[model samples]
Target: METDGGERSISGSSYKRQDEKFKSVRRVFRIMDLVSERGEDLTAKQLAREIGTNLSSCYYLLGLLVDEGYIERVSQGGGYRIGPALPSLHQGKPRSDFDARIEPAVKELAHRTQRHAYAAVLWDGEVVVTQVKSPPRSPPVGVVKGFHGASHALALGKVLLASQGAEFVDGYIDDYGLEAFTPRTIVRPAELHAQLNKVRMVGVGADFEEFARNLCCVAAPIYSASGKVEGAIGLSTTTRRIRDEGQRMTSTVQRAAAEASTLLSDEPDIKDGKNRKSG
Candidate 1:
């Protein structure tokens, strides 16, 4: 009898542990579903309330998702969004060929400008650097591939953000709270909105030491065949260099972005010809 009772006790404990684990897994999925439905508008506190869990547990789950690239925060103290890895899992493909086409343009831009040039895209509600090229003997500009967050402080980021419209920008500012990276960073909603309006009007975005002291950048939008803003290409250099040659560099970057856009528009024709040859 004693042996049988001990066996039953252990079995009951094992079942309880399994039930708890299942509940935790369900909570994770629920969180993902909420973020997907809301689209970069669900903060951690809101998620905790919706999931019927404590804030600590919600944060722990959010941390796990972020570390695994299943979800990402829009910015520090901001809401959540679906991340790059989740869609890749569904499609089982590499980075888009459009990004591949942008790489050569970035390289040429770097050579022409003698500065660090990069391409960025709005991926899953985040500004993601897709490619970067640095001219020989150029100083480090402190950006690289896969760099994200702080979109309001970057020229590339502003181009992408401005394309998304005022409502989205308002939601972003409400959720992300405009972190001031430098004294020049636009921390006020009205000022940021005005700057974004100018970006829309001028077809260019410039960051004058807004992200970091002594660093400057300028970007232009890259359009898709559908006439949608798909990405941006930009050049980064010293503040003095930007002040001295801003107009020239701006034109160079805009021309490079236009060329990249043309290449992207031609990609489908190129792919169709290849398919015909294969057939």
Candidate 2:
């Protein structure tokens, strides 16, 4: 029923709810600004202390940032630090273009989630960060692209391997022999086999201080048009932040990655071609 006075009135609860969202968004932006200025990876504790806030609060904010890509987490000093995004600084054109067809979705994920989102393709046994988005930090850091590394010691590797089917993973384990990077690195073929199985079942894989000392990464595979393993997308963050958010973030990444694969399958061959041009 309209008010007899015909005047506009809003409920207190509605205004408060909107205000809460605004403040929360504002806080998250503030946290990103702090990390951008430091220009180095930061542990959750260190970040909180610098911002004169409690560790728990900082960690919570960091989780939001990671979920949104406002800041990236890396392994550092037995904790997490800042890392680059695929779109940051425009380092890699592939990351920005992401095989052209996938670019729109890739950028959308980065913008919608606000995480240092990117896509990767397995090239010659290496995981290539084909596209990335650093997100809009209070102070942004451009884009991070073309970040590639060994397939054995990173989440990107595990995701791609799992995507390749069990046979490829078995062969890779036999060839690489599960060399340990840190004490945490898996050094046995049998163990890796079991983990790859889990990755296959879950459609995602995780690195917990295995490759790098403190970096914890989560990844999921990208399938080719034929549903073959094409690549992966992941992020390296500190284990601390990962403890609570790993499963959630991995699920998000897995969904996005899987969608990317489905999207690839639906495209015309020339529109979303392979990461590389065949001669």
Model 2 lDDT-worst window of ten: 270-279
CA lDDT, every model vs. true structure: 0.79, 0.64
Q: How would you encode candidate 1's per-residue C-alpha lDDT over 1-279 as one tens digit per residue?
A: 247557534477788999989989999999989987783777888999999999999999999998987787775448877765564444334335666777788899988877899988765455677677888876556566656667899999899989988877877676567999999999999998999999999999999999899889999999877777878999888888877889998999999999889878864422110000011
**Candidate 1 vs. true structure, TM-score:** 0.65
Per-residue alpha-carbon lDDT of candidate 2 for residues 106-167, written as tens digits (9 for 90 to 100) = 67666765666667766544455666665676233222454444566777778776666666
Output the number of the lDDT-best candidate.
1
**Model 1, which residues run further than 4 Å from truth?**
1-95, 267-279
RMSD of 1: 10.0
Q: Which stretches of candidate 2 lie over 4 Å from their true place?
A: 1-98, 138-144, 174-177, 268-279
